[model samples]
Target: MTLRRRILILATAVVLLGAVGVFAVLRASSRAAEKDRAQDGGPRVTRGEVALAPGDGGRRIVFRNMAWGPHRDELATVAADVPEGPRTASGVNCLRFHSAAGTGICLRADRGGVAESHRAVVLDAHLEERSSHPLAGIPTRARVSPGGRLAAWTVFVGGDSYAGTNFSTRTSILDLRTGRLDASLEDFAIRKDGKEYRNADVNFWGVTFAADERTFYATLATDGKTHLVRGDVVERTVTTLRENLECPSLSPDGTRLVFKKRVPGLPAEAPWRLFALDLASMRETPLAEERSVDDQVVWSDDRTVVYSLPGDFGADLYALPADGGGVPKRLMPSALAPAFLD
Candidate 1:
């Protein structure tokens, strides 16, 4: 071969080799980082506390699915925080809040990626908050401690509204210790609208406490902008943890968090696809995924995630494997979201 030709061929081979090397390095780096994140994050859950309810009437804005089974015919106030209206239920995913006190909160609004406005209503096991706070108009959802002393709500401040909820909303924590809905902006991170934030968003939906009551978990939404801000009951200093997701439901043991995942493409209706994230490392794992999923979910021990799935004409309740979904077991098969009472 001519010397010039040989030189050209050799140079071409070296360039190709360099490109391949760079691609290999990038791939390996991504994998290594993911592995480290998972390792440091630990397991998705240690244990979960789940209640059983049939999936029947959760299709509407209101629902009932603790035990009634096929009899889950009546729909009343589930918990504090669902908007007080005629109620609504779409053909897609619905969010239901199940309290530790056998209370369930249901409302029909798209919250996965959009902000919403709602007439905040607080419901005790007896549904008394409805009459008490007849004038309240801030938060749409909240969590009260097992002792019933602490409660938190998600509310709004500016703009018109989002998903039937107030746009430019803020999260506020209520000290039910005084037995009133005082205007205290305790748990909110900040407010952003579809216009200001463009694509970034943050939402607080539910709050839960540890067995000790020292530290608790709050569910939140920010896509890639925020984590449910954690407040130390003792320190009184709120801190932000994790990067995505919200509405953290602690395992009965209080060691793990079974929260909702708000990925990059989830619509407002299908916000949470049922995922788990470690509170320690903040690494995530998918307990469920990409299909029909209910945002109102809690753990029935460490191995099961009880949630509701909307069907053709109605909603059905089903439990997915906490470790990883195996063949899903349909509880009320026709229900929406279920909360175990026992």
Candidate 2:
């Protein structure tokens, strides 16, 4: 072919590709704008004062609002007894969130630049930002100690998804009182099978703090196996308690744990079954969900556990008996990462 003709054909292809790209961008923008509008039959949400500290409101549940509207993704609260009631939105937005006592850890994205960045914001009782730390990647799980003195979060530093084996995670813990930050839990000593263990592929996530401010539990992945590890803030050590457990949330009473177990014979996409572990007996009781749950559950009380499942808008909260009996019940629609303040 002639050089002039070849140049003309290349230029034509470039123009067509540019036009398609612009069309895709416009279409995505339109879809995203729709999320800002309230859908019919959606839960009612209004801007109001939300306190992490328990007072006046008696008992309430604070969660990341997944309902579509102007207040979507903000931290919102409702009476614990009436979870499906009208919500009071707190203007604070978080991709992953958890709170305890009067402290909250909000993992949110900073989209001000060309590339999106994430940060963990330490929030007070009034949902005010106390401090913020830049995150290395996409935020996933977040938790604050029961006494509000410590906070921890896990982010997928590199990976397509947490369910895949090739993913990497960075779990960090911050001490509110001392202003100390452990950027990665990998720095802590690990004890497996009653011996010191070390591996380059160790990753930690899904931290759940115990009543004692110094003790915490988390999922530690190493050597292609996941284990429930008990960590000590002061000792700087983590001891593996059991294998094949991931994303453990310690019970309020500190006697048991609600976690996702990789049950055999399940589909790869949904391999987890919610199970309750008795810390004393090392016993695992499978809950009655009969479906896979990928969340790190939160104990609504000492007897019941709450978790998120995929919903129409984003995710929905559901409650189940911690004893592995009874049926799963939807707690709230369009909600994720719930924390009960009493």
Candidate 3:
């Protein structure tokens, strides 16, 4: 071959190698960004800001702003015309129970490098930070009382597998009116089968409060069984009422309990069926949503139930009739952990 041709061939090979190197670096960067979005619960460029619509009276829907990307640690409202609200502390993974009374609670997780830490931050109704408490594990759920006088949350501890397989949960409650904190239900006196029992494996999660503020309901799990327990905030006592309930949410009228019940013979990944229990009659009625829901159901009104279902892009909120015979309807796209503002 001619010397000039040989030189040109070598130069072409060098250019091709450089192009391949650049392409590989770009691909790796894209993957890293995706991982960060998943861990931070932030928004992507394609997912636009959550559109807001005026609600009844001054009420609005407040939820995590996935469109805010890395800055999406705090909650945002659909009421775009309202004054700017408070922002959450850095690394907030979830926000819950934003109330019209001007108060809410959020869960922040710091997963930087090899160390991980979690926190629960209290916010005023305007979205201003109030208090922050150090938490022990990854946050799974959060809630505020009917009048916004109380706040509660659940976290997963022990290890990642333990949380992933539903092996352990740590639930805490705070009285915003009094600034008192019940760090965990394990500290409360518990009664099982109408008798007091002391067991180390007891775990509690899914707290739902009544209008009275002092009376609440939660799920207590131990000895491979889960029970619905009514608790007294003032007395710090929990009495087991029934079994097979997880993540119970009270209806707006305080007359019914919407909760997840584990269905036997199902795969471990999706074992729960949503049901509404009449508080007065104690009759359990299965809702029309047949899919297994892992969320703590939210009551949109006296007769409508809302919950989140995982999707390809993000979790979406869906509503169904609480009366047990209606089809599920989508409420919000790319949203989870819904709170109705008053």
Candidate 4:
């Protein structure tokens, strides 16, 4: 064969092999995705992560004399058999906590419904007296606002009834410095079909303020359905944006919102990775769709979003870059509610 013709044939063969290699890479990636889905068992949870400052010599939220492991899930759940805690997770010293009052360690019950409650007993960053917060009443859900200005406050207005979940509840801006409640006069109400529905069925759990601090978004749960609802902190009106989303978290800059989407193939309790939504054009996109990622989302800066997923074979904390790159890194066996302690 002529030398030039031989080179031409060789180049053609190389091209053909490159095409096959590309096809193989794509096929392998697809297979790996399928395998991940199988291993995860379902959709993952949307999550955000923040780093905490080693305040006062590595001070952390400490839970009371309770088991702090997987075994404790069913155990503490039993204690609140008829109860709840902060939907957001917190570490020891702070431990994870929630109260119907939203800020204190107490229980609030809706009328004619079962009485359920859980309190977090722990010291503050200053290590002063033991503090009380009510938002931790719900266990799997315990979260404090990114800004300390607004806090979940559960209180009974007139009758002996107290606030909990969706019952006439409002947020209190707690002055961690003065130990007083700062009130947010803005309107934070949810209306559906020209009516007001109150109860856990319409509970708002995922509540985070805007970067401008003018608005916030929360997740509303009704029966088994969940929706992402936005509230105009300045206007006091609630807008239902998306549905089937359980926990909605706002990015630091407030231009985007992250949440979890439910896929039909898995159980509701199955984890859901983070999703993002554009506020301007109202565009929605899936950022990271990991399985087994039960979320406790807190933004780390704007580009770097961190969240918690079950790790170490269901015994550790996993942190991933929100933008999606690299395998998740394990921080600790149980590092939750990780927020920038700055």
lDDT tens digits, residue span 1-342, model 4: 999999999999999999999999999988654543313232111111212324342322222212233222211111111111221212233334322111222122223447654443323332233556554233343444444434433222223211113333233434343555433222346665456655443445556666444466776656656777777654566677767775576776778776776666665457455667777887777664456455646565576555665543333434455555555654333334434432
Q: What is the clash tally of candidate 1?
A: 28
lDDT for each residue of candidate 1 in 1-342, tens digit (9 for 90 to 100) = 999999999999999999999999999988654442212232111111122232343322233422222222233323212222222222122233434453333332434546553433444453333222221244334454544455555544554333333355455444444544434334323323312232345454456767664566664445534466565555544456655555677777555677666555667755556677666776667875556353446565567766656643365556677665576766443344344443
Cα lDDT over the full model 1: 0.48
lDDT of 3 at 213: 78
Q: Name the lDDT of candidate 3.
A: 0.75
TM-score, one value per model:
0.53, 0.88, 0.77, 0.53
lDDT by residue (tens digit), candidate 3, 66-116 = 443554534545432231222222233454443435577878766786997
* Lowest summed lDDT window (length 10), candidate 4: 74-83
What's the lDDT for all of these models?
0.48, 0.91, 0.75, 0.46
In terms of TM-score, which candidate is strongest? 2
Q: 3 or 4: which has the higher lDDT? A: 3
TM-score of 4: 0.53
Error at 323, model 3, angstroms: 0.5
lDDT of 4 at 284: 72
